[model samples]
Target: MNVKLKLPFVGEFGGTWAPQRAEAEAAWELYVELATRITYVELRPGEGLVREALTSVYSLFGTTRDILRRYGPAVSPADRAGELTFGTLALTVLNLSLRPMLARWHPRLLAWEDRRPDDVSKMDHENAWDQIGELRAKLEEARLGLVQLADVLAKVAGAAPLVVDPRLLSNPEKERGGG
Candidate 1:
C-alpha cells in the first residue's frame, strides 16, 4: 500500500514500507533519540564522572540494540537492494560502530566497579578514575555513527534533516500545538 506522509517544509511524499507505514515510523523514532537526547561529553581520565552520564550511554546501547532487533528485519527488499540503504546503515552502526564500543566498555566499567575499594564511595572511585578518555572517544564515535544513521534514515523516509532548536529542548510546552 502507498503511504502518503506530510512533512513540515517538505510538502507531501509517498513510500510503501511493505505491510504498513507504522513499522518505518517506529524505526524513525530512533532518529529523535539520537538527535536530541544522546549527547557527547568529555569523559576524561582523572576527572569526575557522574554515574548518570555512564548510565545514559548504557541506555543508548540498549535502545539501539532493541531498535535494530525490532526493525532490522522489516526493511523492504527494495530498500535492501540499494548499496546505501537505511537497513544497511543501521546494521553497520549497530554492528560496526556500537557493538564494539559496548563490548569493550561494558566489561571494563563493570571491572572498574568490581575493583572499587571498600572505603571509597562509587562517586569517589569514579572521580579518581583514569580511563574515562577512551570511553569518551568511543562514545563520540558512536554518536557520529548514530547521527549518520539518522541522516540516511531521514533521506530514505523523505524527512527533513533534523535541526534541533535549543528552545524546543528546554521548553517542551512551547512546541505543543495550541488549541
Candidate 2:
C-alpha cells in the first residue's frame, strides 16, 4: 500500500520549523520524565505508584496525540519514517513494562475476594475483576494503537533532513581524499 506521509511543515524556508522543533523537543522531555516515573513504579508497585504511573502514562499519551495532530497532512516520507520508528520503540517498551504488572494485579485483586468471602462476596469480586480486566484489555489495545502511531512518527522524524545553512547546499562539493 502506498502511504503518503505527512510532513510537519512545508513552506518557503520551512516557516514552521522553529515552533515544530520546540514542540517536538518538549514532547521528548515529557516522554523521558514519564518513562522515569514508570521505572520507579515498576520497582515499587505500591498502590500510590500504580495510580501515579497510570496517570502519567495517560497524560503522556494525550500530549503525544496532540503534538502529532498539529503536524497535519503535510508530512514527508522521511519524516513519517522517523516518527514511526521512535513511536514504535516507545510503545514496545511501555507494553513490556506494563503487561506483567497488569497480570499480577488482576490475580491479586481476584484472590482478595476469595480470602475474605464475608467482607467481599464472590459476585462482587467477580464483577469488579471482570470490569478491571476489560479496562486493562482496552488500555492494552490503546497502547498498541499508540505504538502504531509512534511508528509512523518515528518514520517521519527519520526522513526529515537535518538543518543546514542554505549556503552549504549551494556550495560546490569538496573531495576529502589526499592528492
Candidate 3:
C-alpha cells in the first residue's frame, strides 16, 4: 500500500549517509540519551512520566528539532533506502541498554525500600557541564550531524511502502518508493 511513515525511517540527502558520520552518531545518542537518561521501562504511573523527565527530553527534542530544521532540506539523495538502520539502533538501545538497566535496577530498588531508580543524579557530577568545553562542542557537532541523518530518515520514510509481509507486497514494489 502507498504509505508514509515515521517508522522504518530512511530519510537522506546528497546520495547517502555521507558528510555526517559524527552527526549520525549524535543522532543515535539523542535516542540513547532519551532512552537511558530521561526515561526507560515505559511504565511506572504518575512519576513514570514525571515532569523532570519531560523537561529534560523537551530540551533534547528542541535542540534536535532546531538542528533538523536548519539542515534537513540541504540533503540530496543519491539512493533511496529504508532508514531501518536508525530505527533498529533505537530499538537496540531501548532493549539492550535501557531496559536491562531498568530490569537490574527495579528489583534492587524494591529491596532498598522500593525507591525508583535515581541513577541519573550521578550524571550531574560526571558531566560537570560547565567545565567541559570540548565535550560541549562535540555534542553540538553531533547535534548538527543528527540533523542530516534525520533528514535522510525522514525523506525515506515519507514515501516508503507499508507492507504486512513479503508475500503481501513484492520486493519490487517496496523498493520502488525509494530514490
Candidate 4:
C-alpha cells in the first residue's frame, strides 16, 4: 500500500504498508494459537483452570474493573453482564459452565469503551501507564493460559482423562467419528 520510496535520511529505512497493522496480524495469529490449544484441552475436561491463569486474569480484570467503575456509565450495560473491562469478559468466558469449550481473550477489550461525546480521544496515555502495565500483565497471563492450559490439564487432572484410545489422544475427533 505504500507508494513512497524511502529516502534514507542518514541510516537504513524502508517504506512499508500492509493490509493489517502488526497488532492486527498478531490478533489473527492468536486464532492459530487458540486452535492448537483448544485441541489439546479437549482431551481433558475434568482438569480445572490453572490457578495462575485464573488469578492473573482475575486480578487484571479486577483492577481494571475498579478503575472502570468510575466510567461504567459510559459503556453500554447490555453488551456485558457487569463492567465492560477485558478481565471481566475473560472471566465470564471461562466461567465453570463454559469450561468445556476453550476460550480466548482479546487484549483490546480490556478497558472501558466510552462512547460519550466528550470521551473521544480522551485516553490520556501518559497518565495511563499503570493501566498499560496491567494490559501487559494481562497479555502475559493470556499467553501462559493458552500455552499452559494443556500442561496444567495434564498436571492437575486427578485421574486420567477418559480418552477412548491412546491413538485418539492426538485426534479425538476420530473417536467421535468427526476426524
lDDT of prediction 4: 0.33
Ranking by lDDT: 1, 2, 3, 4
Between candidates 1 and 4, name the one with more favorable lDDT: 1
Give per-residue CA lDDT, model 2, range 1-179, as digits (tens).
11232221211111112124533444354344443443222222112322333455545546545544554333222555444333333334344544444555545554654554577754455445544454444444434443333333333344332223345664334443432
TM for every model, in the order presented, reads: 0.58, 0.31, 0.26, 0.22
Give the winner by lDDT: 2 or 3. 2
Kindly provide the TM-score of model 3 when superposed on the true structure, using C-alpha atoms. 0.26
- Residue-wise C-alpha lDDT for candidate 4, range 11-111, written one tens digit per residue: 21123322223222322332233434422232222233233233444443343344335434332234434433222322333453133221332233233
Evaluate all candidate structures by whole-model CA lDDT and list the values in order.
0.56, 0.40, 0.36, 0.33
Ten contiguous residues minimizing lDDT sum, candidate 3? 1-10
| Error at 113, model 2, angstroms | 15
Q: Report the lDDT of model 1 for residue 150.
A: 59
Which order, best to worst by TM-score?
1, 2, 3, 4
Candidate 1 lDDT, 83-128, residue by residue in tens: 4334544455555555566677777877888889899988777656
10 residues in a row with least lDDT, candidate 1? 5-14
Looking at candidate 2, what is the lDDT of residue 162? 26
Segments of candidate 1 deviating more than 4 angstroms: 1-27, 40-79, 118-121, 158-179
Q: Which candidate, 3 or 4, has the higher lDDT?
A: 3
